[model samples]
Target: MLVLAFASSVENAVQRQLGIAVSVEMLISAKTKVTSCMEYVLVWDMPIVQFGGGIYRRRHTRIFGDQGHASPTICAYSLTRNKE
Candidate 1:
């Protein structure tokens, strides 16, 4: 899974242009300074509760197990808000 986020904040045109210029410069710097991106792998070695990644639909009850034991029961009340 890959998550990408690009955020740029600038007030005026000059600032925005400068921000773009700086971002391009940084990308070049990163490409030169860092090793291969393909060589690096993102590994999450934590448990389900600790590892924050999931998609919970609305009006659903979800249960989780911990090491073959029942951990907790999580009921999804809404997609936006979670009710415990």
Candidate 2:
């Protein structure tokens, strides 16, 4: 839920700042993961954008509840939607 919330915030920000439009087919995204403290973090250095242009990009770690490990993957986000 935290990750979803963060993603929603990011989407809202983008739509507000850049509007619901892509620039020359640019897909903005963020790396999301839940920490041991249940804190959500967005790795800005993680440069990955899905082909369909989802704001919620792939995850770098496999997290369940508060436990997670370094298992980078190009997975899909269930809590994602293509803006515009």
Candidate 3:
């Protein structure tokens, strides 16, 4: 599944940004860089980065399991706010 999140300081700037909860310690453990935009993160591993095509740096989008047999479409859940 795909998950979209930002650092502990940003908010939902767009419509349809589904919010979820994540602990600060958990986020730190997972190792994430700054993310000002979710658009940039989702396309990090596509054939575009070689051309210097993103605003924020992130780890490559992970495609888990045997990619050859994995589903073409990913199920995505999103968002977690530091406060209400």
Candidate 4:
């Protein structure tokens, strides 16, 4: 996938610059429907390092509402491991 390729490139860059081992992964995350009125929801599990310590983790989710709404497609990437 293109996202995975990008993550790999990023990993290469990080290793080249900082000399730290980092791992990146991508996956489709299922999300629970909050209300019955909602429809066509897409979610992605995107984790990014917030701070420079121990691979800070965060989740990124993108939601698409009902019809006639402009839905945005999002790709998520996460760092599974970090060797500092």
Candidate 5:
């Protein structure tokens, strides 16, 4: 998980440096899939933040295991609010 976080940070930095335009919703969706190995999922209104001159958001939820084990998961969303 730490490695994935690091990679994500790096990717975000690279995207920012390249001035790429991305949606926060899309980022969250991507991150969730990349970080977890779940079959069924659901997401609701998430918070947003500003990073690298863009807006980012995150949502927290509980992931349930088929074997009755559950874990907490955080999904982060990011996007450029301005076009340059």
Candidate 6:
């Protein structure tokens, strides 16, 4: 529910900025498959120190990585047109 609200807010912001509304269908069809993996790197250098693990399994480790932090989560709704 929270993710849906966030997506709706983001969609509204995008529409307002673009001066046009985007169809929800378009948003649903645009989702990409994601595979998350963990890695450790220097904060400043950003070079890989370790790799090949899931964040959940390595939660105790000081170093971790996240990729989909800003990715949008979307929900689909059926399209309907009202005829008067």
Best by lDDT: 4
Candidate 1 local lDDT, 1-84, one digit each (tens):
322222121122112211211111223354566653322223221122212454222222133322212212221212224323
The sequence of per-residue lDDT tens digits that candidate 3 reaches over residues 12-73 is 22212344443322233346675542321121122112225433322323533211122223
Which pairs of residues collide in model 2? none
**Local distance difference test, each candidate:** 0.24, 0.29, 0.28, 0.31, 0.30, 0.25
Q: After superposition, how far is residue 73 of candidate 1 from its true place, in Å?
A: 29
Using all chains and alpha carbons, the TM-scores for the candidates as numbered come to 0.14, 0.17, 0.15, 0.21, 0.17, 0.12
Q: What would the per-residue lDDT of candidate 5 be over residues 5-82, giving only the tens digit for each residue?
A: 211343342343222232333234644546643332332222333578765434331232121112223222211212
Compared with the true structure, model 5 gives a TM-score of 0.17
Error of 2 at 63 (Å): 3.0
Q: By the lDDT metric, which is better: model 5 or model 6? A: 5
* Model 1: lDDT of residue 35: 58
Best by TM-score: 4
What TM-score does model 2 achieve against the real structure?
A: 0.17
Model 3, which residues run further than 4 Å from truth?
A: 1-48, 52-75, 79-84
* Model 2 lDDT tens row, 1-84: 112212233444344322132233334446655333222223222222335566443454223211221212222232132222
Worst 10 residues of 5 by lDDT: 63-72
Any idea what lDDT model 2 has?
A: 0.29
Which pairs, if any, clash in model 4? Answer: none
lDDT tens per residue, model 6, 15-75: 3321222332223334667655433221221112233542122231233322211212111
Off by over 4 Å in 6: 1-30, 43-84
What is the per-residue lDDT of model 4 for residues 1-63, given as tens digits with 9 covering 90 to 100?
221212333234234322223355545446954434312323332333434555433433134
